[model samples]
Target: MEPEKLRKRINELAAKKKKEGLSETEEVERAALRAEFLANFRQAFRSQVEMMQVFDKAGKEVTPEKVREIQRKKGLRDD
Candidate 1:
């Protein structure tokens, strides 16, 4: 689902939990939704980081080896 909708549902569940306790099914649904949200966030973050390139003041590329390796595997960078 969209991030905003996911966030809204999670927040709603959280508010419900804080005000009135949730049933067993609601608790399970909340956990699953939270896990899904985290997975989506991690994937988006990883994609962003994989596409990033860092340069030093002297214009030397300073991206980390792990990130460079990922870029190389994806044919996004040379050397």
Candidate 2:
């Protein structure tokens, strides 16, 4: 599902829960949607972080070691 749609549904479910609560089926659906949204968000965030480059003063590359290691494993950078 698209991110926006997933987000919208999650919000709708949240509002519904706050106002009237959900049936068992709707509760299950909400759980599934929330899990899916989290998975997608984490993947997008990881991709963004992996593609990032950091620099310090004097033009030195200062990307974190953990991120550099991830980039190396993904073949996005050279060791």
- For 6-51, candidate 1 gives per-residue lDDT tens digits of 9999999999999998999999999999999999999999999999
Instruction: Judge candidate 2 at residue 30 and give its lDDT.
Output: 97
lDDT per residue as tens, model 2, 1-79? 9989999999999999999999999999999999999999899998999999999888899999999999999999887
Best by lDDT: 1
**Per-model TM against the reference:** 0.91, 0.86
Worst 10 residues of 2 by lDDT: 70-79
Model 1 TM-score (2 dp)? 0.91
lDDT of residue 25 for candidate 2: 94
Per-structure clash totals for the candidates = 0, 0
Candidate 1, residue 20: the lDDT equals: 96
Clashes of 2: 0
Question: Cα deviation in Å at residue 66, candidate 1?
Answer: 1.6
